[model samples]
Target: MARLTNSMFPSIPSFTDRFFGGNLMDWNNWNFAGIDSTLPAVNVKESDSDFKIEVAAPGLKKSDFKLNYDKGRLTISSEKSDEKSEKNGKEVTRREFSYQSFQRSFTIPDDIVNADKISAKYKDGILHVTLPKREEAKVKTVKEIKVS
Candidate 1:
Protein backbone atom coordinates (compact mmCIF):
# COMPACT_ATOMS: atom_id res chain seq x y z
CA MET A 1 0.00 0.00 0.00
CA ALA A 2 1.13 3.53 -0.77
CA ARG A 3 1.26 6.09 2.00
CA LEU A 4 -0.51 9.39 1.42
CA THR A 5 0.91 12.60 2.85
CA ASN A 6 -0.43 16.16 2.95
CA SER A 7 1.81 19.08 2.13
CA MET A 8 -0.10 21.85 3.84
CA PHE A 9 0.41 20.59 7.37
CA PRO A 10 3.67 18.94 8.37
CA SER A 11 3.89 15.53 9.93
CA ILE A 12 4.02 15.09 13.69
CA PRO A 13 7.80 14.83 13.91
CA SER A 14 8.44 17.69 11.53
CA PHE A 15 5.97 19.83 13.40
CA THR A 16 8.11 19.54 16.52
CA ASP A 17 11.23 20.22 14.50
CA ARG A 18 9.83 23.42 13.02
CA PHE A 19 8.22 24.66 16.21
CA PHE A 20 10.77 23.60 18.82
CA GLY A 21 14.05 22.46 17.25
CA GLY A 22 14.61 25.13 14.64
CA ASN A 23 16.37 28.26 15.89
CA LEU A 24 15.83 30.36 12.78
CA MET A 25 12.89 31.22 10.56
CA ASP A 26 11.30 28.82 8.12
CA TRP A 27 9.26 30.60 5.45
CA ASN A 28 6.80 27.74 5.24
CA ASN A 29 5.45 28.84 8.64
CA TRP A 30 5.02 32.53 7.88
CA ASN A 31 1.49 33.72 8.62
CA PHE A 32 -0.35 37.02 8.85
CA ALA A 33 -3.11 35.87 11.18
CA GLY A 34 -0.51 34.89 13.79
CA ILE A 35 -1.18 31.17 13.74
CA ASP A 36 2.35 30.44 12.62
CA SER A 37 5.38 32.59 13.42
CA THR A 38 8.67 33.34 11.72
CA LEU A 39 12.13 34.05 13.10
CA PRO A 40 15.02 35.93 11.54
CA ALA A 41 18.24 34.20 10.60
CA VAL A 42 21.55 34.95 12.32
CA ASN A 43 25.22 34.62 11.40
CA VAL A 44 28.21 34.62 13.72
CA LYS A 45 31.74 35.45 12.67
CA GLU A 46 35.02 35.21 14.51
CA SER A 47 38.37 36.84 13.80
CA ASP A 48 41.71 37.16 15.55
CA SER A 49 40.57 40.05 17.71
CA ASP A 50 36.79 40.17 17.73
CA PHE A 51 33.53 38.34 17.12
CA LYS A 52 30.66 39.61 15.01
CA ILE A 53 27.02 38.64 14.91
CA GLU A 54 24.70 39.50 12.05
CA VAL A 55 20.94 39.26 12.28
CA ALA A 56 18.70 39.42 9.21
CA ALA A 57 15.35 41.03 9.93
CA PRO A 58 13.53 42.90 7.19
CA GLY A 59 10.58 45.31 7.41
CA LEU A 60 11.72 46.53 10.77
CA LYS A 61 13.11 49.70 12.26
CA LYS A 62 15.93 50.23 14.73
CA SER A 63 13.48 50.86 17.56
CA ASP A 64 11.97 47.43 17.15
CA PHE A 65 14.95 45.58 18.56
CA LYS A 66 16.04 45.06 22.16
CA LEU A 67 19.34 43.68 23.41
CA ASN A 68 20.38 42.62 26.88
CA TYR A 69 23.53 41.24 28.43
CA ASP A 70 23.68 39.52 31.79
CA LYS A 71 26.17 37.17 33.38
CA GLY A 72 27.95 36.38 30.14
CA ARG A 73 24.67 35.85 28.36
CA LEU A 74 23.70 37.98 25.38
CA THR A 75 20.06 38.08 24.36
CA ILE A 76 18.52 39.71 21.30
CA SER A 77 14.81 40.14 20.80
CA SER A 78 12.21 42.13 18.91
CA GLU A 79 8.51 42.82 19.10
CA LYS A 80 6.38 44.74 16.64
CA SER A 81 2.71 45.38 16.05
CA ASP A 82 1.00 46.82 13.00
CA GLU A 83 -2.53 47.85 12.15
CA LYS A 84 -4.11 48.93 8.89
CA SER A 85 -7.61 49.98 7.95
CA GLU A 86 -9.47 51.18 4.87
CA LYS A 87 -12.12 53.73 5.70
CA ASN A 88 -14.61 55.64 3.54
CA GLY A 89 -15.55 58.94 5.19
CA LYS A 90 -16.17 57.42 8.63
CA GLU A 91 -17.19 53.95 7.50
CA VAL A 92 -14.52 51.25 7.73
CA THR A 93 -14.25 48.77 4.86
CA ARG A 94 -11.42 46.54 5.94
CA ARG A 95 -9.06 46.34 8.89
CA GLU A 96 -6.17 44.08 9.81
CA PHE A 97 -3.69 43.76 12.63
CA SER A 98 -0.58 41.71 13.18
CA TYR A 99 2.08 41.20 15.84
CA GLN A 100 5.54 39.64 15.70
CA SER A 101 8.06 38.70 18.33
CA PHE A 102 11.17 36.55 18.69
CA GLN A 103 14.12 36.08 21.00
CA ARG A 104 17.64 34.61 20.68
CA SER A 105 20.34 34.12 23.25
CA PHE A 106 24.01 33.14 23.31
CA THR A 107 26.42 32.34 26.10
CA ILE A 108 29.81 34.05 25.75
CA PRO A 109 32.86 33.15 27.72
CA ASP A 110 33.55 36.15 29.89
CA ASP A 111 37.26 35.42 30.18
CA ILE A 112 37.78 35.81 26.42
CA VAL A 113 35.41 38.69 25.71
CA ASN A 114 35.54 42.32 26.76
CA ALA A 115 31.99 42.83 27.87
CA ASP A 116 32.43 46.50 28.65
CA LYS A 117 33.41 47.30 25.08
CA ILE A 118 30.73 45.30 23.29
CA SER A 119 28.67 47.27 20.81
CA ALA A 120 25.81 46.73 18.39
CA LYS A 121 24.10 48.60 15.55
CA TYR A 122 21.33 48.07 13.08
CA LYS A 123 21.57 49.10 9.43
CA ASP A 124 20.11 48.01 6.09
CA GLY A 125 17.73 45.52 7.61
CA ILE A 126 20.59 43.80 9.35
CA LEU A 127 21.79 43.98 12.92
CA HIS A 128 25.52 43.91 13.61
CA VAL A 129 27.00 43.10 17.00
CA THR A 130 30.69 43.36 17.71
CA LEU A 131 32.31 41.65 20.68
CA PRO A 132 35.86 42.70 21.25
CA LYS A 133 38.22 40.07 22.52
CA ARG A 134 40.37 40.46 25.61
CA GLU A 135 44.04 41.25 25.17
CA GLU A 136 45.15 37.88 26.44
CA ALA A 137 42.61 35.99 24.33
CA LYS A 138 43.57 37.47 20.97
CA VAL A 139 45.67 35.32 18.68
CA LYS A 140 49.32 36.31 18.26
CA THR A 141 51.39 35.64 15.19
CA VAL A 142 54.55 33.61 15.78
CA LYS A 143 57.66 34.23 13.73
CA GLU A 144 59.41 31.20 12.27
CA ILE A 145 63.18 30.74 11.92
CA LYS A 146 64.65 29.19 8.76
CA VAL A 147 66.94 26.14 9.17
CA SER A 148 70.29 26.48 7.47
Candidate 2:
Protein backbone atom coordinates (compact mmCIF):
# COMPACT_ATOMS: atom_id res chain seq x y z
CA MET A 1 0.00 0.00 0.00
CA ALA A 2 1.20 3.50 -0.76
CA ARG A 3 1.76 5.68 2.28
CA LEU A 4 -0.14 8.97 2.27
CA THR A 5 1.94 12.02 3.10
CA ASN A 6 -0.97 14.29 3.92
CA SER A 7 -4.08 13.13 5.67
CA MET A 8 -6.16 16.06 4.42
CA PHE A 9 -5.59 15.37 0.75
CA PRO A 10 -5.90 11.90 -0.75
CA SER A 11 -3.57 10.77 -3.50
CA ILE A 12 -4.91 11.10 -7.04
CA PRO A 13 -4.25 8.57 -9.77
CA SER A 14 -2.15 9.71 -12.68
CA PHE A 15 -3.77 10.20 -16.08
CA THR A 16 -1.80 7.31 -17.54
CA ASP A 17 -2.68 5.03 -14.66
CA ARG A 18 -6.36 5.88 -15.01
CA PHE A 19 -6.30 5.35 -18.77
CA PHE A 20 -4.49 2.01 -18.26
CA GLY A 21 -7.16 0.78 -15.85
CA GLY A 22 -5.05 0.98 -12.73
CA ASN A 23 -6.73 0.74 -9.35
CA LEU A 24 -7.10 4.22 -7.99
CA MET A 25 -8.04 3.02 -4.54
CA ASP A 26 -5.62 0.19 -4.12
CA TRP A 27 -5.14 1.07 -0.46
CA ASN A 28 -8.62 -0.18 0.30
CA ASN A 29 -7.76 -3.73 -0.70
CA TRP A 30 -7.72 -6.00 2.35
CA ASN A 31 -6.38 -9.49 1.73
CA PHE A 32 -5.85 -12.18 4.35
CA ALA A 33 -2.11 -11.52 4.53
CA GLY A 34 -2.67 -7.77 4.88
CA ILE A 35 -5.45 -7.90 7.42
CA ASP A 36 -3.33 -6.66 10.32
CA SER A 37 -1.41 -4.08 8.31
CA THR A 38 -3.74 -1.12 8.54
CA LEU A 39 -3.72 2.30 10.03
CA PRO A 40 -6.33 3.26 12.61
CA ALA A 41 -9.12 5.56 11.48
CA VAL A 42 -8.99 9.14 12.71
CA ASN A 43 -11.55 11.93 13.05
CA VAL A 44 -10.82 15.61 13.52
CA LYS A 45 -13.31 18.18 14.67
CA GLU A 46 -13.05 21.89 15.28
CA SER A 47 -15.25 23.92 17.57
CA ASP A 48 -15.32 27.56 18.54
CA SER A 49 -13.02 26.96 21.47
CA ASP A 50 -11.02 23.92 20.59
CA PHE A 51 -10.18 21.15 18.16
CA LYS A 52 -10.74 17.48 18.94
CA ILE A 53 -9.01 14.47 17.40
CA GLU A 54 -10.28 10.95 17.77
CA VAL A 55 -8.46 7.79 16.72
CA ALA A 56 -10.03 4.35 16.74
CA ALA A 57 -7.60 1.80 18.11
CA PRO A 58 -9.09 -1.12 19.94
CA GLY A 59 -7.30 -3.72 22.10
CA LEU A 60 -4.60 -1.26 23.09
CA LYS A 61 -3.57 0.22 26.41
CA LYS A 62 -2.77 3.84 27.23
CA SER A 63 0.92 3.02 27.56
CA ASP A 64 1.02 1.94 23.94
CA PHE A 65 0.50 5.48 22.66
CA LYS A 66 3.30 7.94 22.01
CA LEU A 67 2.33 11.56 21.30
CA ASN A 68 4.55 14.41 20.24
CA TYR A 69 3.89 18.05 19.40
CA ASP A 70 6.50 20.24 17.76
CA LYS A 71 6.75 22.96 15.11
CA GLY A 72 2.99 23.14 14.60
CA ARG A 73 2.64 19.42 14.12
CA LEU A 74 0.97 16.86 16.37
CA THR A 75 1.95 13.22 15.87
CA ILE A 76 0.54 10.07 17.41
CA SER A 77 2.16 6.68 17.10
CA SER A 78 2.36 3.31 18.82
CA GLU A 79 4.23 0.03 18.62
CA LYS A 80 3.45 -3.28 20.27
CA SER A 81 5.10 -6.68 20.28
CA ASP A 82 3.94 -10.06 21.44
CA GLU A 83 5.54 -13.46 21.65
CA LYS A 84 4.14 -16.90 22.37
CA SER A 85 5.83 -20.23 22.81
CA GLU A 86 4.72 -23.79 23.25
CA LYS A 87 6.86 -26.25 25.20
CA ASN A 88 6.87 -30.05 24.82
CA GLY A 89 8.90 -32.25 27.15
CA LYS A 90 11.10 -29.31 28.26
CA GLU A 91 11.77 -28.35 24.64
CA VAL A 92 10.25 -25.50 22.67
CA THR A 93 7.98 -26.90 20.03
CA ARG A 94 6.50 -23.77 18.54
CA ARG A 95 7.15 -20.04 18.81
CA GLU A 96 5.35 -17.08 17.35
CA PHE A 97 6.00 -13.36 17.45
CA SER A 98 4.24 -10.32 16.01
CA TYR A 99 4.85 -6.62 15.91
CA GLN A 100 2.48 -3.79 14.89
CA SER A 101 2.96 -0.06 14.60
CA PHE A 102 1.27 3.00 13.08
CA GLN A 103 1.67 6.73 13.05
CA ARG A 104 -0.61 9.71 12.26
CA SER A 105 0.19 13.39 12.13
CA PHE A 106 -1.74 16.65 11.76
CA THR A 107 -0.63 20.17 11.03
CA ILE A 108 -2.06 22.55 13.63
CA PRO A 109 -2.31 26.24 12.79
CA ASP A 110 -0.18 27.82 15.46
CA ASP A 111 -2.00 31.15 15.34
CA ILE A 112 -5.20 29.56 16.59
CA VAL A 113 -3.84 26.88 18.89
CA ASN A 114 -2.15 26.76 22.26
CA ALA A 115 0.23 23.83 21.89
CA ASP A 116 1.27 23.86 25.54
CA LYS A 117 -2.28 23.40 26.78
CA ILE A 118 -3.11 20.44 24.58
CA SER A 119 -4.36 17.32 26.36
CA ALA A 120 -5.33 13.77 25.46
CA LYS A 121 -7.25 10.81 26.82
CA TYR A 122 -8.03 7.26 25.81
CA LYS A 123 -11.43 5.69 26.41
CA ASP A 124 -13.49 2.95 24.82
CA GLY A 125 -10.89 2.28 22.12
CA ILE A 126 -10.86 5.96 21.12
CA LEU A 127 -8.00 8.39 21.63
CA HIS A 128 -9.21 11.94 22.04
CA VAL A 129 -6.99 14.99 21.84
CA THR A 130 -8.18 18.46 22.83
CA LEU A 131 -6.36 21.50 21.49
CA PRO A 132 -7.42 24.69 23.17
CA LYS A 133 -7.43 27.77 20.99
CA ARG A 134 -5.38 30.80 21.91
CA GLU A 135 -7.25 33.56 23.73
CA GLU A 136 -6.53 36.02 20.93
CA ALA A 137 -7.66 33.56 18.32
CA LYS A 138 -11.11 32.99 19.81
CA VAL A 139 -13.93 34.32 17.67
CA LYS A 140 -15.10 37.79 18.61
CA THR A 141 -18.01 39.92 17.53
CA VAL A 142 -17.14 42.75 15.13
CA LYS A 143 -17.78 46.26 16.42
CA GLU A 144 -19.13 48.81 13.99
CA ILE A 145 -17.49 52.25 14.01
CA LYS A 146 -19.73 55.35 13.85
CA VAL A 147 -18.96 57.90 11.15
CA SER A 148 -17.22 61.03 12.54
Candidate 3:
Protein backbone atom coordinates (compact mmCIF):
# COMPACT_ATOMS: atom_id res chain seq x y z
CA MET A 1 0.00 0.00 0.00
CA ALA A 2 1.12 3.61 -0.64
CA ARG A 3 2.43 5.64 2.41
CA LEU A 4 -0.02 8.20 3.74
CA THR A 5 1.34 11.82 4.13
CA ASN A 6 0.31 15.22 5.72
CA SER A 7 -0.77 16.49 2.30
CA MET A 8 -3.68 14.07 2.44
CA PHE A 9 -5.31 16.23 5.23
CA PRO A 10 -5.17 19.80 3.96
CA SER A 11 -8.20 20.91 6.06
CA ILE A 12 -6.35 20.53 9.38
CA PRO A 13 -4.88 23.74 10.88
CA SER A 14 -1.07 24.13 11.10
CA PHE A 15 1.00 23.92 14.34
CA THR A 16 1.14 27.71 14.65
CA ASP A 17 -2.66 27.98 14.68
CA ARG A 18 -3.01 25.48 17.54
CA PHE A 19 -0.20 26.99 19.64
CA PHE A 20 -1.08 30.71 19.22
CA GLY A 21 -4.85 30.20 19.01
CA GLY A 22 -7.07 31.62 16.26
CA ASN A 23 -7.51 35.36 15.70
CA LEU A 24 -10.86 36.63 16.99
CA MET A 25 -12.41 40.05 17.24
CA ASP A 26 -12.79 41.67 20.68
CA TRP A 27 -16.31 43.14 21.03
CA ASN A 28 -16.16 44.25 24.69
CA ASN A 29 -13.14 46.55 24.47
CA TRP A 30 -13.72 50.26 25.11
CA ASN A 31 -11.69 53.48 24.71
CA PHE A 32 -11.82 56.05 27.54
CA ALA A 33 -9.27 58.69 26.53
CA GLY A 34 -11.74 60.90 24.66
CA ILE A 35 -15.01 62.62 25.63
CA ASP A 36 -17.14 60.59 27.99
CA SER A 37 -20.07 58.68 26.51
CA THR A 38 -22.20 59.01 29.63
CA LEU A 39 -24.28 62.13 29.48
CA PRO A 40 -27.59 62.81 31.20
CA ALA A 41 -30.62 62.94 28.89
CA VAL A 42 -32.70 66.08 28.64
CA ASN A 43 -36.10 67.21 27.34
CA VAL A 44 -37.28 70.64 26.28
CA LYS A 45 -40.78 72.01 25.78
CA GLU A 46 -42.00 75.38 24.61
CA SER A 47 -45.35 77.01 25.30
CA ASP A 48 -46.85 80.42 24.71
CA SER A 49 -45.70 81.66 28.13
CA ASP A 50 -42.43 79.90 28.74
CA PHE A 51 -39.99 77.19 27.76
CA LYS A 52 -39.25 74.25 29.99
CA ILE A 53 -36.16 72.06 30.23
CA GLU A 54 -35.86 68.81 32.15
CA VAL A 55 -32.63 66.92 32.79
CA ALA A 56 -32.54 63.34 34.01
CA ALA A 57 -29.69 62.83 36.48
CA PRO A 58 -30.30 60.28 39.18
CA GLY A 59 -28.39 59.94 42.50
CA LEU A 60 -27.24 63.55 42.42
CA LYS A 61 -27.87 66.13 45.09
CA LYS A 62 -29.24 69.58 44.34
CA SER A 63 -26.06 71.26 45.53
CA ASP A 64 -24.03 69.34 42.94
CA PHE A 65 -25.55 71.32 40.05
CA LYS A 66 -24.53 74.76 38.86
CA LEU A 67 -26.44 76.96 36.41
CA ASN A 68 -25.08 80.05 34.69
CA TYR A 69 -26.52 82.44 32.16
CA ASP A 70 -24.69 85.20 30.33
CA LYS A 71 -25.12 86.92 26.97
CA GLY A 72 -28.24 84.85 26.22
CA ARG A 73 -26.42 81.58 26.82
CA LEU A 74 -27.42 79.14 29.55
CA THR A 75 -24.96 76.60 30.94
CA ILE A 76 -25.55 73.70 33.31
CA SER A 77 -22.78 71.73 34.94
CA SER A 78 -22.16 69.32 37.80
CA GLU A 79 -19.13 67.78 39.51
CA LYS A 80 -19.00 65.19 42.26
CA SER A 81 -16.33 63.15 44.01
CA ASP A 82 -16.34 60.51 46.69
CA GLU A 83 -13.41 58.97 48.59
CA LYS A 84 -13.37 56.24 51.20
CA SER A 85 -10.54 54.66 53.20
CA GLU A 86 -10.21 52.06 55.90
CA LYS A 87 -7.32 51.76 58.39
CA ASN A 88 -6.44 49.04 60.93
CA GLY A 89 -3.78 50.01 63.48
CA LYS A 90 -2.26 52.70 61.20
CA GLU A 91 -2.18 50.27 58.24
CA VAL A 92 -4.47 51.23 55.43
CA THR A 93 -6.43 48.23 54.30
CA ARG A 94 -8.69 49.52 51.55
CA ARG A 95 -9.24 52.74 49.64
CA GLU A 96 -11.64 53.83 46.93
CA PHE A 97 -12.28 57.02 44.99
CA SER A 98 -14.59 58.17 42.24
CA TYR A 99 -15.24 61.36 40.30
CA GLN A 100 -17.84 62.43 37.72
CA SER A 101 -18.61 65.66 35.90
CA PHE A 102 -20.67 66.93 32.94
CA GLN A 103 -21.73 70.17 31.33
CA ARG A 104 -24.50 71.29 28.89
CA SER A 105 -25.28 74.65 27.38
CA PHE A 106 -28.13 76.27 25.43
CA THR A 107 -28.69 79.53 23.62
CA ILE A 108 -31.78 81.64 24.31
CA PRO A 109 -33.35 84.06 21.86
CA ASP A 110 -32.58 87.56 23.00
CA ASP A 111 -35.81 89.18 21.82
CA ILE A 112 -38.12 86.34 22.89
CA VAL A 113 -36.73 85.08 26.19
CA ASN A 114 -36.87 87.04 29.43
CA ALA A 115 -33.60 86.18 31.12
CA ASP A 116 -34.54 87.88 34.41
CA LYS A 117 -37.60 85.66 34.80
CA ILE A 118 -35.80 82.34 34.34
CA SER A 119 -36.14 79.86 37.23
CA ALA A 120 -34.88 76.39 38.06
CA LYS A 121 -35.63 73.63 40.55
CA TYR A 122 -34.36 70.14 41.28
CA LYS A 123 -36.80 67.45 42.40
CA ASP A 124 -36.79 63.65 42.37
CA GLY A 125 -33.60 63.34 40.34
CA ILE A 126 -34.90 65.78 37.74
CA LEU A 127 -33.71 69.31 37.03
CA HIS A 128 -36.44 71.64 35.76
CA VAL A 129 -35.64 75.00 34.20
CA THR A 130 -38.31 77.47 33.17
CA LEU A 131 -37.49 80.24 30.73
CA PRO A 132 -40.28 82.77 30.64
CA LYS A 133 -40.95 84.54 27.36
CA ARG A 134 -41.25 88.29 26.94
CA GLU A 135 -44.69 89.82 26.73
CA GLU A 136 -44.19 90.78 23.09
CA ALA A 137 -43.21 87.24 22.24
CA LYS A 138 -46.53 85.79 23.43
CA VAL A 139 -49.00 84.72 20.75
CA LYS A 140 -51.42 87.52 19.83
CA THR A 141 -55.09 87.09 18.98
CA VAL A 142 -56.12 87.11 15.32
CA LYS A 143 -57.80 90.30 14.17
CA GLU A 144 -60.74 90.20 11.75
CA ILE A 145 -61.13 93.14 9.33
CA LYS A 146 -64.57 94.11 7.82
CA VAL A 147 -64.39 94.91 4.10
CA SER A 148 -66.65 97.74 2.82
Return whichever of 2 and 3 wins on TM-score.
2
Itemize residue pairs with steric clashes in candidate 2: none
TM-scores, each model vs. reference: 0.72, 0.72, 0.70
* After superposition, candidate 3 runs with Cα above 4 Å error: 1-36, 145-148
Question: Which residue pairs come into collision in candidate 3?
Answer: none
lDDT of candidate 2 vs native?
A: 0.81
TM-score attained by model 3: 0.70
lDDT of 3 by residue, 37-86 (tens): 34687888999899899988778999999999888788999999999999
lDDT on C-alpha atoms for all candidate structures: 0.81, 0.81, 0.79
Ten-residue stretch with the least lDDT total in model 3: 27-36
Predicted candidate 1 versus true structure: per-residue lDDT over 32-65, tens digit per residue: 2332445678889999999999988888889999
> Candidate 3 lDDT (Cα, whole model)?
0.79
CA lDDT, candidate 1, residue 99: 92
Give the deviation of candidate 3 from the true structure as CA RMSD: 13.3
